[model samples]
Target: MASSFAYDILSNKIETRSAKAGVIGLGYVGLPLAIAIARSGFAVTGFDIDPKKIVSLDAQHSYIDAVANDDLATEMDGGRFSATTDFAGLAACDVIVICVPTPLTKHRDPDLSFVEATSRSIAEHLRAGQLVVLESTTYPGTTDDVVKVILEKTGLKSGTDFFVGFSPEREDPGNQHYHTATIPKVVAGDGPQALALMKGFYGAVVKTVVPVSSNATAEAVKLTENIFRSVNIALVNELKTVYAAMGVDVWEVIEAAKTKPFGYMPFYPGPGLGGHCIPIDPFYLTWKSREYELPTRFIELAGEINSAMPRYVVGKLAEALDMRSGKALSRSRVLVLGLAYKKNVADIRESPSLRLMEIIEERGGKADYHDPHVGEIPSTREYQHLKGRKSVDLTQELLDACDAVLVATDHDNLDYALIANSARLIVDTRNVFARLRLSADHIVKA
Candidate 1:
């Protein structure tokens, strides 16, 4: 009866759009989520440690391509969305969503510092009759075992004094087809009341809410999706190298295989795995499965191949430079195109492009890069020791000046025609010039 009454009150607040939603960590995931929640008629407050992000959101500017300037202005101007650097400001919020980063440690282990810090902060300000949801991706049992333990230390009982749940963030930055509002939200909670409240909150913002059995179930769902991609991508990358030796184009082969339309899904080959998800998420499970004495061989294998792609690409660069007599990679001036892992985004966390640049520098080769979306490289978690560099302009003179060009990321907006027409040596890792007939004297597919 206590749990039932709690759900009733939470549902009433959500149905009336009177619930105050507070999102911790105003990043690529948090910002869009806050926007969607605000648009759904709830007053949303965004909290972040970075004052720069707070200022940007307050000024009605969006740093993310998925979120537009006009949308930020609408939320801020309409008095539905506001950002803060203070955690104490979340007091009046009925629902608090944690959307902080869950990056891996230097040793490639699960680093839950962000999640732990967020929980501690939330526990500091946790109020009665409020719901707490963790949207940050992490290993299973983190929401129940870790977060629940931390919050209960405040003498507040979960699902009774307060509600707690896990709803994995399904944010795909730069995806034209799906946004936070359109994607189905998967929700689970510690108990019936908490689950119902999670459903009510997310259902108000997103198109649908998929309720699972438990918080751990919801957590595992996210890891499973990324693990599938990571493993498939590794298989494709391994085949890419094998196919190249046999004079077969993996891209062409994929096109024919995908035509079957059933039982086969196509994953592309790239310089390496990049972005926030594939390179990082699967390892979370790998680290956790060890507590059970079980090894995640497929996860480790996929990561091994994906991480080695930069070296593979660098090897190809050396071979490409060898085409010119006396031209060693150690003395080659190479310019890399695109620094973001995927195309048309500014996120460079674990980006293979940077890894490629580092490899070139290590091999005594001069390396520079250009990405229109990313203007200046920031200090990344994985590549902290990496020197920061600004994005170079894709000029004809710049293209012609380099000894060889490596296409690490194939952004659609970039002029491949100009790069192909001007560069003396071209080592295409992403197959950017596949559709276009290139005129470069020496073109090699890595």
Candidate 2:
């Protein structure tokens, strides 16, 4: 069949919402997206290497907090969506979207291992009619320079024999305001046919489809949005420390500053950067920029400042415990409130609370955490030794047993009033006790 005929056929399928969609790496970004595509009337097949996730999805169970059980079950019951660990299924897909993770390397460089592996697998199954889109957050030129080269090995030219595009994932876990279907999608493709087919596919699923000039533009857009957040968060985190030394309340200051209708946007300080995007995406650019012999000063500085937050939060706990009960952090029994980076989400990727625990344990502190979302702290590339650490329950008895409580994550499910009146020593990093009348020596905003 001619490539033009294949493109026209894929376009017709997308227009009719009958395109067979295949999603790779069904994690936070991929799972919700697969559901959205299935709901759009496409027979979506999700591809993940993990057998556990494949089984769960096949059984109508959702492991991601953003995807509800009912939503997953609806698609499975209708036979619109299914999951598999097989890469051979890619041969049947008209639209294949890659949503793999682009994490940082051990030395803080951009790690493209997952993306490279996915591209290799897709290359083996490179069919002429397939429109392959990368939704992973990565450096520019990755689709053209990296992925394009791999797929061409199958003797088919991108934009000639097959279609390719770049679309970044914008998934915010626990955010009820926007989701996969509502969040506007940005797409850029290798050529005209690739762009049109990509737009038609996402246009069916999302509320709006934003078309950009090139694949690099779509890739850069994701990095730019995340870098802005990283820099702003670094600014406020630095200010939090400077203002704290001046005996000024930074949280209160931010509450007043955000009242201005123009010229200012508020980004609060936390224990540190958590989640997949904020802490990791900017470095993708940083690694790429180095090849051009240019430096990213703001990104490097932000990482330094944000990375120091765990130690800074731990120091505050030490100070609070000593001043309140003349106890050292080494001997003190400290309880961390939440482990997830964001509230109401079970995702603990690069969570600062885990870093807080790591630092405390290094300093001889008896560290334990209590989070409604996470019962046991799972290991990551950074903290492998923290595995199997179960969450401790928060209670009057538990509070009395602990020498100090560190409010690392202020999950809304927790009763702050009960914790405020009962705890003897509290280091509220999130300002959870800001409205409460805490004693001069009992509570300190870290």
Candidate 3:
């Protein structure tokens, strides 16, 4: 098939204003993309296996708090946006985008099952005039190596019979300022024509579109950005531990060092790295590097240091307990504040809070968590032993019952004064206590 056929077919559809667009996996990344494209005057069809999510979206009940409720309602009411669980609806679209989850296995291997399954579905309906863009974060070559192989099943040559590209989702949940329309999108395709068409399409919806050399280069950009974060975070975490031993306040030192305008961008020490991107994305890059006999030592080392932080925090809690009444972690009633990993909202996909809570329990200390956002966490089978400890409402009685309170995350809603006065000992891992005017003896700034 000639490349012009692909371009001509897609151009004809676009000119007719009947160029239907489909998005698979309408979660964080996909929902926003679909809304933006629809708002820009495209008929968008969102597909997800979750019937409940599709139903909610159709009813204009926004599940994610980060997305504006009014915008979702507006899109749905205008007949520009719709969602479905049916795969047959995808065949009717001229362009399809995949934004599914690419999680890791228990052993940290690339779990590409979701991506593979989604690709196969897209391939089933693949036609000569289709533009496919992958927005999931994964290994560098995944767009070219994994997605392309499955897409080729249609016997359609990519960049010729159809267009294909890789454009990583830089969606930062909870950020108020930057959004899908404003954030500069990076995209690359199999060929120059494909790149130009993708650039033109995305440039219509977003503020800026950065075109790279190839699909692989575009995929590598996201991993490199995340790996920089993982390594810098590990460096600061290690320094935090070393400085604590030397009786130095890591928070104060960081405050001082941040004064250097040119040299430093401060990354604070936390109980551990949390969120979907920082903790898990680096491992995917390292896993891919193993195929070429290249070792991602820095990323692997960073993972080691960051993962051990929960154990280190447990040790700090034990030491704080000993200082108060000379009691070991055994029988220590500990209340952990903020189970949602970060502050202000609920999202615990790869939360370090899970491991932190487990370490506390393993050390013979009873642990309970309090988070206004999270009600109940679905426990994996391995954690069935610690089931049924409900997230207590942040009440005075609940706060006073624990022997100590650990501030793993600092949200604005938490009453620090109440926590300071009620709990016997407080271990502040996220520097929550550092910003307070309260007395130092009540809180241990770990």
Candidate 4:
């Protein structure tokens, strides 16, 4: 039976205040969710443990380029959206969404520390009639196995006193075709009422809501999408290596196959895999499959091939350098162009570009990177004390000075013409030089 507090709020039909929403972990995923909900006429508060992010949001300055500045200003001005680093404020909200990070541990095990910590905070303020939805991408059973246990510690039974649901976020950072409102959402819950309530809540804002059979199904859908990408990308990468041995251009082969217009989708080769999703999500599935005494052979194989790309690129660079003089990589002045993972934007999380830098240094080459969006990339486990490196201007002087230039990422803002004309040697990993219309003699594809 629904509690009096629940009935009272639901009876009024909460045409407005029924949902005082709270969004936890305001990073790439949560920030957008908070903005979308607030814009849909819900009173929303975004919670983040990072004080700097909280301060920036309080000032109505959007840290993420994906969210429009005008929208942030409007939401802040209307009092519909606000942000905080405090956890106690969660008690005031009717619906709480978890969008925390689910990164891998050092040993590639699933790290649920952030998710666990966030749930404990929510448990501290658990109340009746509230609906909790997890928007993080993780293994199946995480919602029930991880979050629900912590919430029930408050003696509140989920799906009875409260509701629980899983709705994995479909966030593409630099994609232009899809926005939060336009993309169809997948939702699943513990029971019919929980499912209906969530569908009703999200339907008000998004264009479509796809209800799955269960929460585990919804979680599996998210993992399957990423695993497919990992497998396909790895397949094409191996083909690139084999086809190159046969003196065939793999990009040309892909372009020809893509013309089929049916049963064929194109995934290009690169220096290596990157971004938070493609490189990491597949391993999550592989990790969970171990519990069932099952091994994801294809997933592990793809990971091996994809992870070795940086080493492969280094060998290609050495071959390109050998054309000039028969010497090793020592004292080689190599300028790396476009250090971000993909093209157009600056997001370096798990970027293969970072691995490229490390490999270059390990091979006795002095590596320097230039990216328009990223001014500085932090030194991590593999790249400690490699800081203070600024993104240099892609001028003629810089291009002409370097012995060789490697195109790792294809940013649209770069002057590819100047690079083709000026650099003594160029190794193109992204196939970006095709757009430059440069002479064939000046470029080498990896």
Question: For residues 22-49, what per-residue lDDT tens digits would candidate 2 score against the true structure?
Answer: 9999999999999999998999999999
**How many clashes show up in model 2?**
0
Q: Please write out the lDDT profile of model 4 over residues 214-305, one tens digit for every residue.
A: 88899999999888998999999999999999999999999899999799999999999987788888888899999999989999999999
- For residue 382, give model 2's deviation from the true position in Å: 1.4
Winning candidate number (lDDT): 2
Alpha-carbon TM-score of each model against the true structure? 0.97, 0.98, 0.95, 0.96
* True-structure lDDT of candidate 4: 0.85
Question: On a 0 to 100 scale, what is the lDDT of residue 239 in model 4?
Answer: 98
Each candidate: what lDDT? 0.89, 0.90, 0.84, 0.85
Tell me the lDDT of model 4 at 55.
87
* Candidates sorted on lDDT, descending: 2, 1, 4, 3
Q: Which stretches of candidate 1 lie over 4 Å from their true place?
A: 1-5, 439-441
Tell me which of candidates 2 and 3 scores higher on TM-score: 2
RMSD after CA superposition, every candidate: 1.4, 1.6, 2.0, 1.9
**Cα deviation of 57 in candidate 4 (Å)?**
1.5
TM-score of 4: 0.96
* Model 3 accuracy (lDDT, Cα): 0.84
**Per-residue lDDT for 1-446 in model 1, tens only?**
35455567777998899999999998889999999999999999999999999888878889888789999899889999999999997778989999999998789998898889989999998877889999999999999999999999999899788899999999887789999989999999999888888988999899989999999999999999999999999999999999999999898999899999699998889899988889999999999999999999989999999999999999988987886645898988899988998887888878999889989989999998989988878897556656578888989889767898898888889888777778888888877687676635577788
Q: Give the lDDT of residue 124 in candidate 3.
A: 90
